[model samples]
Target: MDLKNLFNVNGKVVLVTGGSRGIGEMIATGFVSGGAKVYITSRSADACDKVAKELNARGPGQCVPIPADLQSVDEIKRLVAEISKQDSHLDVLVNNAGANWNGSFHDYPDEAFDKVISLNLKRIFTLSQACLPLLSAKASNANPSSVINIGSIDGIRVPPQDTYAYSASKAGLHHLTRHMAGKLGGDGILVNAIAPGAFQSKMMKATLDAFGDIIKSKIPVRRIGSPEDIAGTCIYLASRAGQYTNGAVITVDGGAAVSANL
Candidate 1:
């Protein structure tokens, strides 16, 4: 095993949920570029198909989009079953599907909290559990398979305003990452998280457009995140290079999280 090749994911199979756009799409693209056979899932079949077609056309690595809504536990099981039918084992799972609704705490209805927690926290747990067997089967001689949970900087710190449910849900997810990693470590299945700061997705773009300069000015890096930044972290965590790392939350926030309060 060459040290540099440890980061190579060639011939591995990766399943990324919510991979039609935003951070998920970027991660799928990165895996495809790195030579992994990638399977992406989303609620919209058309969106998944479109992205899959685009990725498969770009490289030798295959990208198949399997339409499944993470909110549905049965759908997640079915998706995993379908994946198992096609491939005997799975090498990586990136649970990145999530959404948020912004409103003042008093105005934030119960529905908001329910929806955020359902998608962000509950869905991740269900899907990962469904895929555990396959992940264990893929763990091997030299390299161990991995689970990379997508998190956010807001989960680690207060963001100055509302998004309370979303923030709290992600914070729970961060703790879940640690717990799962510990329990799964003995199986050679590594679990970790990537906490990303401002990225150029529809969600962040709206925030940037609304407060672009003010937000950028406050950051130590004087900029928001990019798709490549998140992709790079995912590749590492999923690849053999990161086999020794478990229960770690790698923050890709461009120094924002470390900025001094003073």
Candidate 2:
């Protein structure tokens, strides 16, 4: 009945991987802006500290930065342990760290493929597993913890660019969201994915630069995704409004993928 507080996330503790840039940064900002205590991580210590400092300065909330390369299990454990040192429980976790490679079908390097899969897919599971304690510690039947996976529309439809590893990894991530939801629901940990469309990200800069107008023309919304668009979607997922929304792949692509099917 209290609709005003339906999406309230004040005082919540959130962790966002690759939170120094792109969608991760956006999600972190959304939480911090809503008075949540947010922790952001990245491979670059400088990047992590910089974003955290800036958000902290602009806050009714607080931001912490934990910089650790997420390529190996050891590093993932270190990151989670560090979080445990600071907080007893986590209200939200956004697995947004990712990488991509563009190459011809014949000339794609094996290392590039492995690199994309390692960060985008393998590391997510590792980090999420490591955070199980923090995630489930304060989770409950009425108010559950949330895990938001940042996937892509490329996984649902063939992208115009040559990012085989990125697309395939996202598709796998979408399914993994469902798998984890089934496994974690009883513990009151909700798992879901947000498959984003084109946004102003370093990864999308070249594509948007080359095809920004054309890309917008094809979509039903006729525009690329804004930071607010992604930020709002994530906030909803972490808020009370989305407690029942598990195992769902919500596309925040301005209807690009759906129109593609039509």
Give the Å shift of residue 120 in candidate 2: 1.1
Query: Model 2 over residues 97-116: C-alpha lDDT tens digits?
Result: 99999999999999999999
Which residue pairs overlap in candidate 1's backbone? none
Residues 23-129, candidate 1: write the lDDT tens digits. Answer: 99999999999899999999999999999999999977889999988888889989999999999899999999998979987778898899999999988999999
Deviation in Å, model 2, residue 126 alpha carbon: 0.5
lDDT of 1 at 212: 83
Regions of candidate 1 where Cα sits further than 4 Å from its true position: none
Candidate with the greatest TM-score versus the true structure: 2
**TM-scores, each model vs. reference:** 0.96, 0.98
Candidate 1 lDDT score at position 140: 61
